[model samples]
Target: MSKSPIHPVSSLDRQSELENSPAQLISLDRVSFGYSHKRLVLQDLDLEIKQGEFLTLLGPSGCGKSTILNLIAGFYKPLLGRVTHGGEDIKGPSARRGVVFQSNALFDWMTVEQNVGFGFRFQAVSKHERKKRVETIIALVGLRGNERKYPYQLSGGMRQRVAVARSMVVQPEILLMDEPFAAVDVQTREGLQEELLKLHEQVSGAILFVTHSIEEAVFLSDRIVILDRNLGGIAHDIKIHLPEPRYTAMNRVSDAFNQYRTDLYLKMKAIE
Candidate 1:
């Protein structure tokens, strides 16, 4: 298999690059947020997601991993500091950033093609173009023949595939996934992970994923950030180094993959 075009950068190297690189796609500068004034879930947090990189946020429950993703998605306003995309404030959700929720979020009434092509309904793309785009994305996600099927008829994994295709069909600059595969069985989740990696390569967009699974995080991320609980902010930020074509079965049991998983496990254990 061909080697990955993008290699993971070391933490030190990443810091240096962050200081000088102009490729910062999304940024949270000293952002602080809370549901109630008495307690803050994230306080003065700072993070930068570079262009076309697969970055995952990992930590225990209540660590604000999902909160961070929501902030970037513009679902909530920061109590202090800012969330910016391409140097502009993110006032609200935009097509530039597509989001996949923990649930599949597919429309029960719509067929596979309609659900995947739903985004085009609001856009100005021509009918022929919309059909072409929808068909291509449906096929890309391996749902060609099932175009007429509804979400209720599909399996859990298949439903998630439609959800992914829906978000990706618009070609957003970044995709924010909040435990999107968490609802599936272990075997099915692995299949989705591999498919997601392949899609990421083809889409060439930045991905900011939030998950509690260490193995899943390591397997899919180019870089991983572990959040500290009780608004302690970020605890650890580590880069992953694994061979290209990470979907291969060997990667699951490989030495490098194990090392990263073990290290992350210990770090999260400490946080808990």
Candidate 2:
């Protein structure tokens, strides 16, 4: 059988591409963090997220994946090293970096449009501008007719869509997603994944996604980083090279797909 047309660029080529690409949006250099200094959750970590890159963190639970996200989000300051955005220290969360959790995190009392436009209202943006932004994002996320529906009235997938619209409506520079599709059923998860890819194309902002599913990582990531549970550091950094319009079902079962999955599975298992 022919190899899947998806081909990963050579390491040298990747390095050149990165060097020529946009500057890093987020960087973690020699970082260490933990609830108590005695037990470091992440140690000597160094990472860079370039603009328009889809980077995924994959590891066993409790390997400090979420901790890394928290650090980048500025929820926790690093015990050592620095977390920087655009070469300056990350002081705290900002609209420049929007976050989406596994839970939809939508306001129950607000309608879909209300929830999406919440940020603008708080900033006292003009009413017309808020409505235009909210409506554009609603249509982008495929939630047009349900603008007035409350969170409780929507399905799990629909609620998640609302959450995404809320984040993107502000045009953030980076999106942080923590297992945002974990709660949905298999079919729903697949659909959300496709939707997210479409949304990424429209926004073109950097993404940092955390997930335990190897399949999920393979499907959505442009680059996958595996954390070593024992050492609390990076175990593997793998780049995905897949054809454009990556959703064809055949791509999931292609030789290249299985190879990527098998390679990651073995690496993760060895860590265990």
Candidate 3:
């Protein structure tokens, strides 16, 4: 068990950043948003995702977990506050901020290689470089032999691999995932979780994940942020104390793992 290079931010420091211009990979300053003017799903939400950090947002239904991800991705704008990446305002979606949603979002007509290289095709990358890049990403996600297969031909897990490979091929600075493994079976979900940890070690970016599962949150995140639905703000911020090289064989069944899960479960229950 080795110590991982991840830290949880102090509440005081986090509060101070909203007012000061800090060095952050992504920053949300006093952000507030809702569909209609009558109700605000999130109010005055402040968060900072540092480089190379793995942060997860956990909350009950309708707590605006996905809303925060969308705001950072620039799919939706904040009504009152600001969302920025690298100290610049996020006006719209860009390839630099990659997103992976629950649905695979793969085109049924495109093969794995085509799906992975789609982003590069729009850029000035040559055909040879695009193919090389796609091959590398496919291998990274364990989809080497299935490059010729279409979305309908592969299983749920395989389709998700294609989605991940597609997003990663662009070489984004930040990766945002929303319940990416929620559709798979328990065994497959655990397998994907382990694969994701391995991928995180290889990739160089900050990850902001949204999930409703307590065990999933504890297993993957360096820091977990719990949101209270009624208050529309963060209720608890916890730093996971477990060591690195997380695996289902040893780390998942250890005493420390169970303790973190127990603590996070109680926190979620208390918020409800």
Best TM-score among the predictions, by candidate number: 1
lDDT of 3 by residue, 1-272 (tens): 01122334443443333224244788999998989766989899998887766799999999999999999999999998899998999999999999998998998999888898989977888888888888877887888899898999999998988888898778788889999999989888888888787777666677899998999988888789999986469898887756545544577888988998999899899888
Q: What is the clash count for each candidate, in the order shown?
A: 0, 0, 0
* Per-residue error (Å), model 2, residue 165: 1.2
Residue pairs whose backbone atoms clash in candidate 3: none
Q: What is the TM-score of each candidate against the true structure?
A: 0.92, 0.91, 0.90
Model 2 per-residue lDDT tens digits across residues 55-131: 99999889998998888888899999999988999998888888998998999999998999987966767888888
Off by over 4 Å in 3: 1-22
Task: Quote model 1's TM-score.
Answer: 0.92
Better of 1 and 2 by TM-score: 1
Output the better candidate (1/3) by lDDT: 1
Q: Which numbered prediction scores highest in lDDT against the true structure? A: 1
Pairs clashing within candidate 1: none
For model 3, give the 10-residue run with minimal summed lDDT.
1-10
Residue by residue across 82-113, what tens digits does model 1's lDDT show? 99999999999999999999988889999998
